[model samples]
Target: MDVACAFPTTLDTPDNIAMAESLGYVRAWVYDTPQQSPDVWMTLALAAQRTERIGLGPGVLVPSLRHPMTNAAATATLAALAPGRVSVAFGTGFSGRRAMGYGAISWSFMDAYITAYRGLLRGETVEWEGKRMRMLHPAGHAPARPVDVPVLVGALGPMGNEVARKHADGLYVTFQPPEFMREYSWVPYLAWGTVLGEGETPDSEHARLAGGPGWALAYHGAYEFGGPAAVLDLPGGEQWLAVVERSPAEERHLAVHSGHCVELNEADQAAWDAGGHSILTDVTISGTRDQVRRKLDDLAAHGVTEIVFQPCGPDTRTELERFLDAAGSHLKPA
Candidate 1:
């Protein structure tokens, strides 16, 4: 099975990225969170110079947060520096307007961003704000290792996935099963599977990890195409947002943290299975290596091309050591 380790969205450090490479991770994925974390592109650029072969990119950059022109420039620069190692995943970001101080845009905006971004990558000159611009350094201009930079769309629902299929080179999903992915044609569907650390208790590691920044996934389902307002149409959506908005920080975090485990329940499993989602749907690869190997094996059986492991909490080095030790036998050679 192919595996990669995630950089904590808010608490990422160079030491953690370095450790992941030493532990045999093929790709070191980072996140693009505006409110509390360092900028994803700059961090990845620094990380690019620090590591040799590991892949790097924002697990997601909210399309709504910046113009596609800016994204195009930044990604192009990274591709130039890192060559074939950069993969850009664009998506809708959600937390709360309070945290980021901005409202969400519509799905139509997402379509425009992808179309424009891809066009630029192919050396097509696109018109923006009454001006025509193309990639400054076209793909064929330099022999600096032909760029294999893939633009991954952070898809959460069928609609988003379908749209992604029409434009993106690959699809990056969070907390969704392989069965659902089977319906799509995107070749590489990378799932954000979190491998909870081992501790004295079954959920101790998970709890500590949950309280950290990546906790947004627990309350909110995957990446928000927009803010809470973006998916108000989803089932139990408005009520869920209401809870997130009104509850105190601690209370809201507890609610968000618990949502992830709900996906593991029998009813949820039956619903997901009935919907044709493969058994590799649960994104958390917690517990011992023996246990995680079962999940990894199941994903391979279901045709998962890559499993992106999002590590959380403070001690990334310790967690990474445990993960590599347990799953080392299953990994492909570096």
Candidate 2:
């Protein structure tokens, strides 16, 4: 597996990047949220300077939140700084800002935003407000020279997956079986694996530390909205987001399976069974190094090219350190 450390947009401190580099992690992915977390591009640039080989990017930034031309410019600039090791992923609402006291935005707008953004990235002038807008200075100038940072789109279901397949260089997948993913033939798949903690007691603590409450809210958003994919291209989707916001936190969060940050005995021992670890293992990648290796190998068998660790709990540094220790042996460069 191509193991990379994920930094929450909320908690990514400079020290975290330094530690990830020392431990041999290849990338640092931060969340992108205007109200909840730091700016993804700026944070990534700072991290890029701190580490030599580790890739930097947003786990997923919503295009609706910013003009695509602007987003492309920012990402291109980061690529200029980091050269070969910059990437980004885009997604729809995972955090319902309306739930946290804000107006909701629609998915249709997001689609248009991506279309416009891609236009700018390719150096085509986009028609805007009875006018045209283009990249001020595209990174690639000569015909032989081209900006090559990989762009990924988060795909939780069919709609978004299709979009990712059509528009993005790859797909950012989460909480879905590799078998299911294969049916779609998604190339360059990046699986999201979150680890809360380690050791015998990791399961329970990982649950609490993962802020079960916050994820519960996210779950409610997905479920009520007919999975994250269902909302894509849905007209007035923010109306549904508003509903989830009104619902109580406890009502929305319901565990899909046992264990927390790490794996259960059954999950580790019988991961290859029909159900295996896929469904139940939705939210995390906790377990011993060997256990994680087995799970990642399973994903690889089904075509997951990269595995990005989702950092949970209060002390992200501690969680990342443990992950490095457990999974480092398997992350040897191919």
Candidate 3:
């Protein structure tokens, strides 16, 4: 399987992309949460100038955040800079919209947006708000006529998967195991956190701490949108819900959006402790190197083509290097 690196649009993103390229990662996907990170397109522009071999683009840019015309233009501009290396994935906003106190964009809106955006990319005129529009003066350096950029769709639910199956080149999924790939035949790109070490087992405390932040993200997503019943099936769902129940109702939102890593407040930490190793194993790639290889083998067996590794913790670069040391051999060159 090919490996990609997903980065928050922090100031150091270009450097991170360069480093990942040097370490043999095939792609660098930047996040599009404007409230929490830099503009993804701008960050990717810097990445294009900084790295030569790695694929570069937004991991999943939210369609609701920009007009179809704006997205089409920006994508064309990026393709001018990086050509075949540029690809885009569209998603119904989650953190990007939630952080703004809004909900996900309706699928109807996304459906229309994708149709228009894809048509625009192909140098065809598309009907927009009320009028027809097209890229009148395409960049000479951009990929020709049928702008060969790959379009991926981020999906979690059945409806979203249907949208992807109908309109996109592939699907980007998170927190799903290999079995999911078998069910969905689209070219699959899986993203998950990685916290493997030389000798620590999946059940080791060190492994749990390394992987806990990612597990917390999954937990928070279910807690915020799916409610108590949605979380009940998870390993420590009951205990996690109880801790949230104890918190001031207003402050619960703050707890869920706490900084990227797993450094939760005392109460949150207690809940995390309650989840134990099973929680970490569920959402992250954690275990000894050999164990992680087995997991990768399983994913490959089930048809996962690309694996995007999301490195967490205070020292993200170090965490990334650790992952590279353990799995770099599996990364095919771009």
Best of the candidates, lDDT: 3
lDDT tens readout by residue for model 2, 70-138: 678787778777877878788774542432333344555555677777777677778754678876662
Better of 1 and 3 by TM-score: 3
Please give, for residues 218-308, the per-residue lDDT of candidate 1 as tens digits: 3244313355565353333454565555657545433443323212322222223233122222334654567767877776666565677
User: TM-score of every model?
Assistant: 0.72, 0.69, 0.85
Q: What C-alpha lDDT values do all the predictions have?
A: 0.58, 0.57, 0.73
Ranking by TM-score: 3, 1, 2
| Predicted structure 2: lDDT | 0.57
Best candidate, TM-score-wise? 3
- Tell me the tens digit of each residue's lDDT in model 3 across 1-334: 7878787688888998998888778888888888778798889998899888899989788988898878888898888888779889888876677656567887778888999999988889999888999877645645565676888888777787678777888777765543444554544454555556665555565554556666667666776688768766676667767776765766665555555433444434555666544666556676666666667777777777777777765576776777766665676766
